[model samples]
Target: MSKRHISLKDLANELKVSISTVSRALKNHPDISPELTLKIQKLAADWNYTPNPLAMGLLRQQTKMIGVIVPDIVTHFYASIISGIEEVAKQHGYYIVIASSNESLQKEIESVENLLKSRVEGFIVCLSQETNKYDHFEKLNSNEIPLVFFDRICESLDVPSVVVDGVEATKKITRHFYENGCKRIAYISGPEHLNISKNRKVGYLEGLKECGLKFDPQFLVTCNLSTKDATRATRQLLTNKILPDAIFGLNDTIAFAAMKEIKNQGLKIPDDIALVGFTDEFHSTVVEPSLTSVTHPTFKMGQEAANLFFKCIRNGKGFSEKIELKADLIIRESTLK
Candidate 1:
């Protein structure tokens, strides 16, 4: 049978000392005699001994592990953000525990509980689309856990957050549409409760006013950010008495759905109706008539969120700040007209 790795107890027994003494000696604690420290160090080296991270963490009450939550992990958007977060985490000798809410509030709550049980030192989160309540997060805030949010976040909470200026991005898209000679511009928004939808709607209205165009309630519609809902919204807009000459979807998923629905109705893109989307996904380039979209600084947003989390850890309780990043409108074939 293969030999088992020796434990601290074995080392203590062999050296005729207590386990605590062996541990302190290995650490070269000043309280340990120089001779005993050398002996313990040599024995540890010869035995190929290593301290257990989990055990040490329990002893010191420092996990050095951060919990991270996002809407979903399949998209390049969240993946890129995770990469950036990991980069920062490694620099600080910390690890991240990731969880996906999958756009469900219940799942988000469960994830929070599970990560807390894991004893993660802190959390970095992007609220799910369906997360309308803040009670689950409020508990962490009340307990003074190191927490930072990114992208979709709770603005009411006194927690640090990193996000893009959706308002300005949408405004840019609207102005681009107007400059392209589209008068009846429409915007497809997400749920009313989402901060993203609210911010973009503000920008859309501002853009319309800036272009000297009156706001038409019929031109704006809401979707659940799903393909079917987006397609239905698109159909509703198309069937209006005065059809929109341009359309902007809250995200690529919505835009792709709108594209299909528009094609189904025999409408020519950038001819009968121009289109744009937010979150420039990779598929945007490969799709026929490449979609115009808002390119967010996802990686940077991740880095900022991680940095903010560490800052909160250092500053201790009741610390909060907000960081806003900028996004650019990538004009493409779909909006060229």
Candidate 2:
């Protein structure tokens, strides 16, 4: 081989600076001092370094790449949404760079910064469960970056977003439980800080009131949306003096954990304890006493987010919109009794 190709990363490593800094120096951005810019330029010339053709194209016109960030990438929930986003993006002559926060706030921030360095034209994000502070997102807005949020979003930010009607979905679940003669219904919720938890709780309370049932504090419990924490929450309700006749969880993971715990305690689903869950995950049908759940329009939600992101790019800063999609309850054996 004559010589190995030198990429921006390699140049950054040699210069002991960030990739973004090196990139700015190469572009002769005003932010980079003249002395440092000259040094970087001379180094690149001596090394015969050339930028990626695609990156050069992006500098000439647009990156044609959209950054997508989600709490987790392995879930069916996210996979479908990403498919939809890609479908819409490809139709518009754009591609996507996906990043997983893995449900960590710090990782979410890192993903944003890294994507920015890549110079993606826009971003579509779903908030991680641990994202209580929204400064990272706010920074994106302050810089006039085209940003859109889906599913779990930060309401404090004025960015465009797409979400399922969690309040209405939970209300439907509560109504189903009440219609099935479940008086003392319980809800296992996620963290209080999450928008999903707050909206669902509101619906649960409103549904109880609509059905002429008292909102019993004992029947409500919060978990961190982990299997272990969900199991603990379920156990807490089960051991109560007056056990709830029906139970629903924030998502299928929580519902699955609750189902296992309920079985371990010798409770019959829908007979002694009706069960329902959100997200309508794949295993919802395969599980014994097949779970009833809310099926979100996930693909549509993603398409809408991507569509909204393009709109934001065209509209520039101070443009905001919120799209709330509907979800339907899938009746199954778990709540039929």
Candidate 3:
């Protein structure tokens, strides 16, 4: 047989006090005498009483639970971000519920609907690859529910967001390749609809201009950000009559695929074709030649997003805030001669 868990009602009955009195005493409310509070604390300790979050939230009209939605949870970047969010949430006596959209617009919409049904007090999100329309997020804003975005965000929407400067980060990487004596630089990009992709492309062009390298139309290739797609893009670039001396992928995942394909084509890294990628993923170090890439402040970005959501909640209204964090360039064997 199992012992029954103690509740406030049970405590009140044992102490011969009202349920409200027991609640106040347990919380150390000012109205409750110190002696009574101490008595309640001792009894609570003896019974191993733990206040139910759901019951307490009902009384306060707050769930004390923040909802987090990301493109993919399996990615280490997003996982680190979630860690940062959880750290700050625990400090504020709040918890979080997480959902992954798998880069699909429909899944993102469903996640939003389901989290709302759970009565989450706020939301932190990173938009999906196919999330161009802002209707679902707009609805959350219309209802005055506090929401914050991180990383891949919707620029058209008026909301608080935390992101790194994609343009500057990519520009630095492109310049690094030029300094390594790469006359021709090629960039493998993702879908045009993604803001990160657009910003990175712009940066690549600007970096070329700075290096006195002419932009070649044939050097730019777009793919779906999948490994297979990236491999195809790399093969296409390799087949060009004038092959690029260097290749840059929008992210490490694509870059890894590009590296594999480049090797398969009998090219030596840096000696034949220098390679660079963004978002310094964990696998970058374990590859045949360590990848040179841009390091995103993913954990800090998550903390800022959650902090922004809390700020909105305290203010009782949304005020647009755009917080941009800096990214670092990490040079590795892949880019070294």
| Candidate number with greatest lDDT | 2
* Full-model lDDT for every candidate: 0.89, 0.90, 0.87
User: What are the clashing pairs of model 1?
Assistant: none
- Model 3 score (lDDT): 0.87
Write down the TM-score of every candidate.
0.82, 0.83, 0.81
By lDDT: ranked, best first: 2, 1, 3
Candidate 3 residue spans exceeding 4 A from truth: 1-60
lDDT of 2: 0.90
lDDT of 3 by residue, 35-55 (tens): 999999899878656465223
- List residue ranges in candidate 2 displaced over 4 A: 1-61
Off-target runs (Cα >4 Å) in candidate 1 are: 1-60
lDDT of 1: 0.89
